[model samples]
Target: MSASSITSQDLSIGQIFQNFYRVPDYQREYVWSESDAKGERGEEVEQFLKDILSEFEQATKDGAPEYFIGTIVVCPGEDSVFDLIDGQQRSTTSFLTLCALRDLLVELGETVPSTLAGQIAAQDTNWQGETRERMRLDLQYEDASGVLVEYGEGRGKNARREGTRSIRNLANAYDTIREFLSVQFPSDANGLRRFHGYFTNKVKLIRIETPNVSRALKIFETINDRGVGLDAMDLLKNLLFMKAKQSDFGKLKDVWKGVTQAIYDAREKPLRFLRYYLLATYDVDAKLQEEDIYDWLTRNEAQTGHGIDPIGFAERLRQSALAYQNYSRGRNPAGGADHGIYNTRLLGGSAVKTHYILLLSGRHLAPDLFERLTRQIEETMFVWLIAGVASKDYERVIVQAARNLRRATDAATFAKFEQEFLVHQKSLNMQMFRNALLRLHTYDLRKFRLRYLLAKLTRHFDVLAYGEAGRESLSHYMEAKNDIEHILAQGADDDAKLEFGEGADSFELIQRLGNLMLIEASLNRVINNRPYSEKIATYPSSQFLLARCQAAPLTIGVNDRITRAIQKLDPASSWDRSAIDRRQQWIADAALEIWGVPSPNPKATSEFEMLIPSPNP
Candidate 1:
């Protein structure tokens, strides 16, 4: 490890970029196009420019103090160039702002200050007397760098118009700065020049230059620990690159890139993925904290036998990331071939995060065994989530299951593992699940969770109606723009109040699970605040089982104890508290069967039946 030197000094933007800073190939592309004011990035381009100009505007009366922007971490690289380890986005935006201002100056026929132009583009001459035009801040992406160089050279008319995210963002930043300055100065060359002077001289950054990349990465991590921008995943990537051999660095980079892109594609947090990965791969016997991943890796170096094999670890990480991505989108990792779709549908959603570690670790199982395990895990999650089981206990069970799954070499072993760890657990048993369902009311649940439950029930009823499963899963319906509709309108008009008696208790009955149906948003809007008779008449148009049930009676049996309870009621009949109670009982009975809640012992059933309260109670 190289010794690092850290110092903080306020340097103007021009001085910082003029020192020939280069964003290396491994660095992330410019992502500061959006405003930090929107809670996306730090110090947006417009705000940054406005702040600098504000200081400049106040300079006449009070001689403005140096405006501190933020810190930038750089390391001395080969050939007198500095690799930007941090603050690339800020530095890149600053350069673009300067270029836009310089172009505006050129358009006004003012002498573009040589120093300003130098900061934009540096001219280098070799012994052959050939001059090469190099951008002061060379970005990793060629198209973006080209935009900066072309615009900086006063060729704004010929800059690249369309390209990658970085290119488009750079161009947008330039246009924004140019337009803002043009409006603020309004063709006044003197005001523009005065503003430029303040910008290049006043706006400051604490530049921390390091001796090497290793030291630079450490300093970068230290500085950004307090900020939301960087986390353990970013630092881990840097550490992996630092620890890997020079020859293996390229492969490590590619794998890390894939892992990041996969997680991004999945819309998952990188730190969360890393924590899950650690939990899945290592049998920690407890929840792995996000901040402790790197430390755990350091302490468990012997697990890999040799020093941490970045390539091997990265390959596993990528595979796990792919599994997570597939599970997130309700698609199987094995391309949804064979019975993989069943597993995908069974283990997809926000509630499945509890099962992610187990699924990820067992991703390599055979198709049949994998699907079986997925079903068990899904059952466990469904029971635990709906039953309101303690999250800590849920996590512990899943973690233990994951560890056992990792050790199981065959289908029989995995089956035993599931029976021992999940199926046989008291907290996840069918009876508890049944008891929980009996207590649930759609009105008491979150809108999304309620929708999910109703959607699943819809699917279950659909399978009974068709004698086969439907094409859409619970996740598919939830992901679609489906709205939870109250069968009894929330707000009844005068005629509706007359039809269905006007009482506060009647309104309260409308919120229960039996009165709810998942329907299209547009249809829900159309039926909004309508009478039950009018709403029931529209049910024939809906494709969902719950809605279709209102068209006619459909007796679909799940078992001897549970059957499809939804039935068409007379549209002209008054929908009162009794009606709501009947529907709630029907839905609860179906739910008990749907969630696989077991019945009490035969000997105790008569006593239990007497003790069990009715749905209304």
Candidate 2:
């Protein structure tokens, strides 16, 4: 459960630490919205400053409190070095405070250690580094971005602005301290001198040294909970440190950053991105618990397995993902389209359930027919729900059905085979695909319908038809225009309407086909601005007229014909239970022909058994 603690070491603030605090690419990106920073601290900071001022009077009367100003945590390393897990904020703030003090000290003609103020101003080292070139007179702190921007800029936008204001406040605090020192310590140099003495001697940093990575991580978490929140990248970096093999860590870390950055910048959820990567790389779902994920990565299992080398695995995974993405883009130079949308969704490590099914379908059916079937299955409202919700299970059943369909297509009597295959079955095989399809069908379209309708209305009413032609010419106007909702919902266009209809919300806007389409360019653009209400206003009347125009002799209902066919297929049992009767009769007809068996009564055991193909004489 635990590893022995490694040696503990201390790292000075001046060291230029390279590759020491590097974040893995698989980690979540820095995402601090403006509201987060000032939301809580706005009041607390004001109180703290007032308390500090109040304490100043008491401090002068009662002497300073027994405690130092702040605390920093230092986790020791093997050779007198330490990783700055928590306390980057305090350290960086202190560094800036010292820089300002040092600058003020020089202006007061005070002696410092060999241009000490210059070291703080240098950009090469991010304070955590030890080298002279990377050295800073102030403590270095890295934000989520892991870039060495100045402390003021390192935090999120609001924090950056707040930090600058805090510095100005500090300057004023020092100004007060300068006057205080002048009266209290008459010979003292200035406020800078007073601030330096107060911090260098009065400040105390609580250092904890743990040899084990797990305990270190636990400590990291505990400390972060106390106001120093670690970014996702910070946690992921710690994980990679424990998970990655020494040799592969370098390259894999680079690849991890590349992969994660792309996903993060594109606004993907961390868990979803991780799941997608794992599925693509190892053909595995993120079904395992968090502990199991840690164990798998760190080789902390009973086998004493060295965990998967995150870097190497990540590099290989990146290559795989890139290949998959390139392929998914349907832009392969091989002069072929992407196998199918199904293949794109089911990209995985195993051929059994991956794009191989697409290959099987392409080999057996014409591309146009296959594409039609694909669009029918995947583009339906019901199927898309399965994809969006239960993707893995959906993929499994879809692949299975595609496999079965492919097998059936190669059989004799292609039309009957197709018809039989399309017929709903009461068996588990049929139920699974049916369930997947139904999930999409009953999906809530209320979220998306109005957004689409509104966008279309805007394009037709606000821009195209209304702008130049006006309402009178709307009937004659026609133009190549795209679906407003579809383009906006898919994030394709800028003309999307924010408000679609009354009582329609964002979720409802997501489900409609009108919200999902792009107007083709070849169509007329003159009618693009016409309102959908007006455009389709004549359809009902036209349909009424068409009923008269296309009147023909009456024909028997198809269900009656199907019932007659069913009676011929099964004569012994009385037809009842509409579902069973319909399905059983269809099965009897298809199976009898496929297996060379004679049909029997609907209620007879022979009729039911004959529905499934017989294993051979």
Give TM per candidate.
0.76, 0.40
- At residue 373, candidate 2 shows an lDDT of 43
* C-alpha lDDT score of every prediction, in listed order: 0.67, 0.35
lDDT of 1 at 73: 90
Q: Model 2 compared with the native: what TM-score? A: 0.40
**Superposition TM-score, candidate 1 onto the true structure:** 0.76
Candidate 1 C-alpha lDDT tens digits along 1-617: 14745666678976786778788767666655532323343336778788877777778655766788888898887556788988887788788888877878788889988888888888777667888878788776443555566766777656775765567666667767777888999888888777777888888998988877777777876776633456677666666766777677667767877787688667777788888877888767465677676667667767632255777877778888988888776556765742233433443345457567777888778877877776666655655666556666667656766777888878788777765665555222445555555556655566656766777677666666555444434555665677877766667565555666645236456677766777877778877877777776766677766675553544555442224334322222446666666666666667656654444433321100111222221
Tens digits of per-residue lDDT for model 2, 223-287: 54422445343444555555665465456556766655444332334443443433323323335
The runs of at least 3 residues in candidate 2 whose Cα sits more than 4 Å from the true structure, single-residue gaps closed, are: 1-134, 137-205, 209-240, 243-249, 279-309, 320-377, 380-617
What CA RMSD would you report for each candidate?
6.6, 15.9
Q: Report the Cα lDDT for residue 228, model 1.
A: 46
